[model samples]
Target: MSSLPLTRVDFDAAATRISGKVRRTPTLEAVACKSDPAPGARLLLKLENLQPTGSFKVRGATNTVMSLSDEEKARGLITASGGNHGLGVAFGASMSGCPAVIYLPESTPSSKAAKLQEWGAEVIVHGAVWDDANEAALARAEAEGLTYIHPFADPRVVAGQGTIALEMLEDNPEIDTLVVAIGGGGLIAGVATAAKLRNPDIRIIGVEPIGAPTHHAARAAGHLVTLEKIETAAGTLAPRTSAELNFGLISAHVDELVLVSDPEMKTAAEWLWTEAGVAAELSGAAALAAIRSGGAAVEAGSCVGVIVCGAGTDGIG
Candidate 1:
């Protein structure tokens, strides 16, 4: 499928494709804790952190890798990522029995690199940031004639990520809003499309780190724009620019955009650990941060769904 406008049907088909290949991560009512909700507010957390790779990136990576032709698979898989996506590729390749090479920024956490190696990936540490590593991966893919899996820009990846929405709506049809963290916008794009298709009135709120507000910047400019620099601890959410297709999807389906500070995310992560016993990374905690920090306002008693998308960090404490 092209990066055309996705519908609920696409998400449904993706759910079918990824069934059993990925975990059907759970959704639970937010536990009462330090990050307690506003009076009458109800919070539902989608725990994608439980995925085998400790992140939602596996859903898309597995779908993309499994969809490859036998010949393409033989050529091997190659991709670039900050941390979680690389781990997703490594895990997906292991499942598919394909040789894989993962390019990562030098700044990537040691724990993530160790995980990639544990999954048997040829880990190449290059560049100082994700964009730099991404450029290297692209050139290497062309030079080596390898199949490249984009972290978030490809349609297949987006469709795979959309499966989360299908499961969410299935488990809780009454959800009135979905709060999701945005990086390259793949997850939010796919989710917004599916959630809106399921219920046209369902609000899709996209959250980004204030330091890496690619989606917010793009929205403000009315087009895709690159940031001069990024400085967020949420490495997974630090893309220089949003993809064009993702921008289109966001413009068409996402209802609002909010930005949260790095410290807010840390507090949210700590709250998840202390209150809910969930080990969330900074990126994973962004949606909840948006809510707790009042960056994304919700009416009291509204059924709010927040995606805790990853847990690949060393520790939340």
Candidate 2:
């Protein structure tokens, strides 16, 4: 990590490396509705939900898993996720016939655990938040010599996530402002790093749930900080603390962070479903929530990109 600078994240290499291993998910323009919040703003949706695991985390997990040595794969893969990354790691390991153990928080939806199980990964419902599950996962990895993949901290994972930036920018170079949701900060970290490096003039806006403003608080304190408890229904976005790697990249590359409420996300999700038929999870609709709720002060008439990052029936339900 010390050797790698923010400018040299190598998103292109990650794109080519993970080429056929993952889908080059398509992007589409969000046609305006009569009730549009930001009228005249050109909104483009990078539908990462179309990915095999129904989240962008697969890009990072597949890149990391494919980079592992055969001997390391034999030792098995271990990681903790609120939900999405677990599915990613499980799917990635399955391609190699490697065993994987996924540690998920109690907050994770049962549907996610069932999906992970479908990939042949052992699912352990651990503590209440991502940090608690992560602690247990790290302990088990250390105890059994398993290869642990850090969701946000690893350079490989960050680089993989950066590939989304490459694809989106290439697909539409006019995109001036990119709005992304923040969880442990991996997605935004990678997106900001790649987008800023690729086009220094591009603005990056990060969104988080108001209930779990981990990176927002970290940015406020100008250093890492942990929360007392989690409260957001966007479980994937409720990590109490942000990783140092993600914090550094986000602090360096992201322009500003906005916060949205759970209700706002639900509303945005409902809007997406009604308007575009995008059945996104609460965390996945966070970027749209920020824009729709005017939390992100995006300039009107400017082209903007938002990633609908995960899939679920929650909003529709």
Q: 142-215, model 1: which lDDT tens digit per residue?
A: 99999999999988889889889888989999899899999988899888887877888999999999999999
Clashing pairs in 2: none
Name the Cα RMSD for model 2: 1.6
Candidate 2: residue 139 lDDT (0-100): 99
For candidate 2, lDDT tens digit of each residue in 250-306? Answer: 888899999999999999898888888888999889999999999998787899999
Give the lowest summed-lDDT range of ten residues in model 2.
1-10
Clashing pairs in 1: 40-301
Question: Candidate 2, TM-score vs. the true structure?
Answer: 0.97
List lDDT for all candidates, in order: 0.88, 0.90
Q: Residue 285 of model 1: what lDDT?
A: 92
The positional error of residue 80 in candidate 2, measured at the CA in angstroms, is: 0.6
